[model samples]
Target: MTIERIRVLGLGKVGELVAHLLGGAGFEVAGGDLRPRPDLGFPVDVFDVGDPESLRSELDGFDAVVSCLPYDRNLGVAEAAAVAGLHYFDLTEDVPTTTRIRELAVGSDVVMAPQCGLAPGLVGIVGSSLADGLTDLRRMQLRVGALPQHPSGVLGYAFTWSPEGVINEYINDCEVIRDGHRQLVPAMADIETVVISGDRLEAFATSGGLGTLCETYDGRIRHLDYKTLRYPGHCDAIRFLLDELALRDRRELAGEILVNAKPPVDDDVVYLYAAVEGQGPDGLTRREYVRAWQPIEIAGRMWRAISWTTAASACGVVELVARGAVPGKGFLRQEDVSFDDLLSTPTGSLFRDEVAVA
Candidate 1:
């Protein structure tokens, strides 16, 4: 279907920017949230997103709907989109939620794409692109971080993204491929140091970051893993909270406490690194792609690095689906998206303008 009128649910930081980018791309974008949002450059409605019937009613006459609500609320929105016969998209990293969406898309005609955020989204695309050029692929490592530019705390982090999502990834079991077999490992285990652009950061296994890559590359790649990058001592501090303090059992309180501690920051940086190792025509070799992205001006305003990057990646896929550059039917995997095609889109090309790290 040709996408024109698009409805965006949830008008938080990332959702607002997603609507902005989609509107800039020439799509008729309307947004919905719990409270009324004024002067968003598009029409917005205040309604109950939790009710599937209300959401389905709101989705009528729209060619597509983008859910930027919390991961838990996306399934209801996806079901509403299915009922409305409209294309569905979301930026969720919740495994169970994506699994249900996949089940919903089994025989559906509209496209259902989830986990269109940074690690699971763009990193998967980059890793797959690297693997496509190798003869004997041995391993693929993907890492990403969103941190304060000038950190001054024990955790050395700022809540650039959702606090609940961050806590979920930290406490859940991570999926990986080890020794050519799929396996489940504990989150925050197997910590390692990663050096990118002269910055020393620690990386550890995180759940939902791999998306469907473990299933896609199982037995094909010898070992495949994805990790979240943080400054030194961050993992230890988090372990103290989740393990030693026994806060893992009470995730809601834990999220509230952590968010109270390290709130969102305006000046932040996002670091991404992807490496592939395999046998080429000559011999064993490695290929890598690394970048440090900072906040920049977009549509006459400066946005957080994490905010724009996430919005750009999410909207880029939407633009591609609208143009038929990406598949318009059934489930859409982020790994299946072409990196070159993503970069060619108006919003996806934002990744090309990286900050020069010293």
Candidate 2:
């Protein structure tokens, strides 16, 4: 159960950080991408994701594989993990891709865990912890967002994470539990303003943020939803592109335009917020958790808020699984993890604090 080696798939913003974090955490980490990124200062192999033969071969020796690739490109890596008898983890928020991984994990000995980043990963863990005290849980709301430390663009946002994932979130229907039933809600349809510490931000429904919590809390909770937090006008501009400009059908082009227009920022802030309301032991109760994290220097390297948080989440889960803290079989959900256990790890402690998890 001791994980001495791990393979990280992809070497982009989050992937590179994952390699650094895992390496520093004393794991023999090898990063793989379609192209070589030697500057990462780790052993990186070149392999095309479309070529399953090469992927499975590249993944053969690792104890676990963490896919930081775009959500669309995760299945091949998951399959490669299955073929290699290694534990599988990914940061995908795509519901269909997750379903595919679940189907692939069935009857397999290796563990399969998806949605191991930010909203879908940490938020779900926090949600479960918060709901534990509620005698009759009525509602739960999860919101997360990463923005430039100093906002200047007309969109008031920067390229914090994957552009493809952002566009997919905008165009896809969000899954939520309402009236004690699962339903698909339109993304960006419900816009609400929230004020935290003098900064007023807006939140809107976004797809795949809920992970598997809807199914876990369906009949137990009356209402549950997840949304993305952004500056006041950010959602409106994205809605314009997807709805008015007819970019919904042309997601690739839309992603290119957005990525081309926005410059990536290393200095950024990530926002986390969760609200729970229900009848506790005494009476009707309500509690909320809020935290704003800034770019932090870790292990002698500086990383953006989004990069560190996203990578930490995936690494944290794999670390637990590698240490025999988590099961190594079938599909796993975010709600299956323990928040306290996650915080005790070196990687997950990046988000540990009274403010971060309060």
Candidate 3:
């Protein structure tokens, strides 16, 4: 049977990008958002995710649904998609939300895939692909960041994407496999510095980057961790506010302060670097480096690095589903797609040659 069409839920930056990318690739793409979006430049139906009956009606006639809504709202959309028998995909990093989606996928006829952005998305795919070939893995580190190309503020960052996600990354408890034990480490801890592509960058513990790798590689890898990369002094300042000022307890007020204070930007850069060292049959070997950065332009628009990576990564997975490259049922992880498969995909191929390592 010919696939009918692909519907993207949420017309935010990421959702809009997904719609355009998929539409341009020949899929009949439609979009839904809670609020009317005049800036979308295309007609997008307004659909309330909170109203299940309305959401189900809106999702009808589509072969798949890609949610770009907040992490908390994703499960509702996923449920609506399942009831409609449409494939489901999202860019959420919240572990609990993802667990609920997985449960919703049980005995379903459609697929449910989440964490399709930079860290939980391509980083998991690339990092796990490297680990798959290793024997006796010792230490694995994954670092990803999206920052403005030019900074004029003291924070040295821009609100290119979700501010709530940024706050969650800073304040949420992080998962780390240290000394052969899985444990929770407070976010923004374990600060460290590294150089990528001749530029100095700082990295620290962040939530949700590991995805399910901790469970997948548990008791096998000695030390495995994921960190968010940032410019110098970025982590220190954030830590000062979230920790020293005790803003973690007041995320809403902190988010307001950040949104009103720090401006967003269009010209931005995304940094992705992973290192895996282990002993193999031949001896000791380490695969460590960064991907070559390729600026992205979509729908005659140029987005900052964060927008490019996050949106493209998600659209790539949607393309995979449309082509039957992924399972049609059950929960899906980002690591399920190999680097080769991702590079071969029409949407994901854009990053195949763009990765550079130090």
Candidate 4:
């Protein structure tokens, strides 16, 4: 799979960055959005996501399609890309969407990989890597947060990422492996606190972040869970909207309210924490991987911490699959990618060695 040309879907925050990074990385990259995109100094085109012919023309002659479209829209793009004889990758965190993609991957010659962003992306790769070394795997915990370095507002949060994604996690039931059995847990429950970089943050169960890890490690691990970290009091405020206001039943309104109210911030941070403990050759031991990323300037422009991380994760894999490092066919999982190999990718190396809390 020598990828000489690539097509990126969506020109939103993360999609724009993905196109920029891929272009700078020396790939022949073109970007498409439902509407015309501004001249970002790269090749961008406009197409309707709902029109099959539009997607076909937008994605024509590209070796791969990196979907930054909303989760609900990815299936169509993926089917189009498969028809175009191109590999399909996405940043979606929706479980049902991934399941649909998995079904589409069957008997297809190209790769169909979704949930390639952070949390469901790198976090799974790291957690599985650590769990692989345990002599007797017991419990694994993953926590990630994209937060404002300086927090304010009544919600104590700003949209450094997708507001709809935040709402989806709040209302959906999370899947976790408990007592060696797959279990469904309510979202935004199981409040806990973790101190990273000396900043105390709250964490709770979140849907879709776990991806396929539970099924991949099912019947083997005792306890496994993934949670989202936020500043103290953040979860309670979200709970009020979901429970007290009954906004869970009114997702469209809740999404709009949060999107209109919680403004996006450029000054943001991404916190990562993964820990696994169990019996080892020597004894029971624990190893943790932690990171805190700040916004940085790239290609003569600044990218939010979330934007860069999320895009880089997907773009990095594009390189790996092009080089034949990953399986070219069948549905893929983040755990299917090797941690060391992923870290060796240009984008994966960005978070490999850096300043993270000890």
The runs of at least 3 residues in candidate 3 whose Cα sits more than 4 Å from the true structure, single-residue gaps closed, are: 1-3, 38-42, 292-294, 353-357
lDDT of 2 by residue, 7-113 (tens): 98889989999988889788999988888786777998988878988887887778888899998999878877877788888999999999989898898787899
Model 3 residue 249 CA deviation in Å: 2.0
Give the poorly placed runs of model 2, Cα more than 4 Å off: 353-358
**lDDT of each prediction vs. the true structure?**
0.90, 0.86, 0.81, 0.86
Q: Write the per-residue lDDT of candidate 1 for residues 1-358, one digit (tens) a residue.
A: 7899999998887999999999999999999999988877899988998876787788999999998888878999998888788999998889999999899888888899998989789899889988776776899999999999988788999887888889999989999999888999999999999987788999999999989999998778999999999999999999999989999998888889998999999999999899999988779989888889999999799999999999999999999999998888899999989988999999999988775454
State how far residue 166 of model 3 sits from its true place (Å): 0.8
Model with the higher TM-score, candidate 3 or 4? 4
Q: Comparing candidate 1 with candidate 2, which one achieves the higher TM-score?
A: 1
Alpha-carbon runs more than 4 Å astray in model 4: none
Give a tens-digit lDDT track for model 3, residues 104-131: 8898777888889887888988898887
Ranking by TM-score: 1, 4, 2, 3
- Go through the candidates in order and give the clash count of each: 0, 0, 7, 0
What is the Å distance of residue 152 in model 4 from its true position? 1.0
Q: Count backbone overlaps in model 4.
A: 0
Best by TM-score: 1
lDDT pick, better of 1 and 2: 1
Scored by Cα lDDT, where does model 2 land? Answer: 0.86
TM-score, candidate number 4 = 0.96
Give all TM-scores, in the order shown.
0.98, 0.96, 0.94, 0.96
